[model samples]
Target: MNDFPWLSVLLVLPLLGAITVALLPRGRDALAKQTALGFAAATAVLGIVLAFRFDSGGPRFQFTQSTPWIEAFGVDFALGLDGVALTMVVLSVVLVPLVILASWRDAERSGGTGVPPKRSVKTYFALILALETMMIGVFAATDVFLFYVFFEAMLIPVYFIIGSYGGPQRSYAAVKFLLYSLFGGLVMLVSVLWLFPLSSRKVSEGGLGAATFSFEELSGMTIEPTTAKWLFLGFFLAFAIKAPLVPVHTWLPDLAQQAPPGALVLIVGVLDKVGTYGMLRFCLELFPGAAQWATPVVLGLAVLSIIYGAILAIGQVDLKRLVAYTSVSHFGFIVLGIFGMTYAGQSGAVLYMVNHGFSTAALFLLVGFLIVRRGSARIDAFGGVQKKAPVLAGLFLVAGLSGLSLPGLAPFVSEFMVLTGTFTQYRVAAVLAAVGIVLAAIYILWMYQRTMGGPATEQVSGLSDLSVREKVAVAPVIAVIVVLGFFPQPVLNVINPSVETTQTVLDRPGFRPQITGDVAENGARP
Candidate 1:
């Protein structure tokens, strides 16, 4: 453990608050909400200080701690933070508190349907805090078994949230989500079981070590080409389910429309990153040979998702569902960057995740605002909103333009890096992906024009402009998007070294990751 157990404290505060909230009286709903916000705020502050203290020149993992949990089976309760995981930790800490604040006014607000309260305020806040703990744990755990534990545990709270508090088709959507996610889990579990023995042989005399699940140890070893490919499938399947890539993504659009607005924003914006993060962490580091072996097949799939997601998005009448499909299209660029195997591609992919997080959050939150007023998410339901709500229109433009990766915005730099890198390795994939980018412009601009510029609908003309608090809620996110565009060096400084370390692991003999970085080193094209 580092001198300070800051990571543990950060993970535990929200869980402890959940307990405290449960003890408070029913009429103390305001007190419960305040307590939740307080814990989230404290965690955010800690995450900032941890970021400042983090040495950018250090090894891959830091602030590490380990303790034995199940010695007989060779599992331990271990935790650590790396530049990549720590970045996500900071994002989560900041976003969760803001989510609490965003939902503050709606405290104790009844669910969508007219039914007796099946869950108490204490229980609701408890689930939120519990979900936060698991989310952080997923990023921080170094032990493979521990990571799996946190990963599977998170589904419980989220499933209940959408099922109990969501819209009309909540039950159906919840079941579909469960089925897709569970299948992935079973596959991942089988892979983990196979990995344990192979790792055991490498670390000890045919016995798994207490520190067997530690990422550094596992990464230092190698696996056979045939075995590595099979293990990679376990992880990829799980991430694809979570990432909801392509043909497997049918669940997201339906779930988005059914879940509560706050939940939808958090699920799509923050939680979904866990899937991509897992691939970067486990599939890349733990199974580098397998990653290289599997790159082409997955690259093909990502291209399919890009064109397919965009085409589907263009035809959507449901506004919320339209926004949901855009995530699939955006993640296609991320996958292309990863498999392209260039430092620029992977780095751009990393930055894209952060950029996408902020932009998507704004879009979803803003749409939620519209739904509250219009009582529907149909694109045609919103006509000439700019006439009545100028601020709202402007905010949507900022988010939409960011989504389109307009130059001068954060995504542009990353997208350029990704496309440039992909051109060298996956030339045809890059070209097809470019078509997806053009579709990005078509769907985004067209959706904006149809909703914001036409004659004001008779019903929506009286809609009020964004409240000061709502503007305050989203302004920081927009500022981050524009600010990062101009000065991405700070993020790149952290990202480049970590990305280099990943490439080093992938370049070992007998494994080829299709990587290219001489351009950046030689100060040429890339």
Candidate 2:
């Protein structure tokens, strides 16, 4: 199993599917949808197989493969997975088919009430499959250069998806998304280029002996403190924009308002995770000293994002924008967990990524259904939805509650872990961050009441319940949320080991471990 090219195959399957879907003759939209769904499902099955074969206690990086690509620069076509990467891979694969299913009618002219998609149905599905390939590749790439390639290349399909198939302001939104991402990428590229010469220099001169982009090699090398901080900032800027943390998070609500709901699912649900994941995998691992140096400021920004996002969400008139703001808030929690620098904190942060994906996906899809029914995304455009579509209302409520991290839901456990872990170290920050939870309940319930409660308004009185396809699309996500809420130990078991490895990296001298008085007394550091 270790000898198999698991990650390569996982990436290729979706790429091949995209090509096959695109090449099919015109007027076969149904066939294209089926073909794309089949390919996504197959890729998902492979991901599951890979996950089951993963040994939690085995080598840090399993199913590894490395082959020189640009040998002159020591870059390689490398791919590998630790527990964290594996969990993310599984999340991406599992969501793609579900997104495909939910978006079954997204490209068709008669699919819904809003302005129809301008692109061909076949092209739409093809873009989705192509995006899947990029998502998997970004998570799997073990070479820094290869990871950057996947990172920037992701913009292509997403650009087209939003600009071509999205709503009235899509072109503007797409351009904004592109420009922000491109600038971040360019800055990071400068940092990436800088690493080569540094790596080529001799160890006595603070070099790693050979120029290389292999993550494992680079992580093990030591760079000057000032140089490491700059590199760390470069990478952190890219991830932060992607994470869309406060201040830099301006692009997301605009994108969410304009993008098709299905595309939005992958954007917030999975794509945005690349930022948080990079913070966990690259930033902290490669520059532990800088990471520790930046902890105080990072935690401050995270707490600010948490409050700012929730407050804005409370004032949103548009359903899609409301969900988008909620995500900004949720991401703050993820970031908070990460910088807390404790085992429980990092582990919870990782699990939060997966759980948030499902909950946010469900919210966006349900909102999409509402928009389709009424031809508007405004909260005022809906009323007494429950009277006409009980199932839709019920499901929306459950998804909404999950977003608020209600007890016995998937998000609650992860949220709790993150707070528990962070509280032990950064007590004030954790306490301040908890305020976001209260605000979350306000925004979520208020949105639900306006959209789903009360007497059936004439406009929404005729709203139909979820169709069979819609039900099938959302059932699995909801099930996962409920199941994981009660039994998260399984997922935690897989995530804890990798987080332990990360803790080991962060535990070097000069980093403080404030998790408990006993640890401080014992002279333990992180």
Best by lDDT: 2
Write candidate 2's Cα lDDT for 72-93 as tens digits: 9989999999999998899999
TM-score of each: 0.94, 0.97
Itemize residue pairs with steric clashes in candidate 2: none
Single out the weakest 10-residue window by summed lDDT for candidate 2: 109-118
lDDT computed for candidate 1: 0.80
lDDT of 1 by residue, 1-526 (tens): 3788877888888888778777888877778888887887887888888888887798677888788898865777888887778877877777777677665543244232222334666666666777888888998999888998888888888887777766678789889988888888889999888877787676565433433766777777677778888989998999988986887888899988777666666788778888878887789988888887788888898899889999899999988889889999888888888877777888888888778888888787788777767767788888899999999999999999988899988888888888888887778899989998899999999999988988788978789998877787778778988998888888888777888888787677766533347644665432
Listed per model in order, the count of residue pairs whose N, CA or C atoms clash below 3 Å is 0, 0
Flag regions of model 1 displaced more than 4 Å: 105-118, 204-211, 513-526
In model 2, the runs with Cα more than 4 Å from the true position are 109-113, 202-209, 513-526
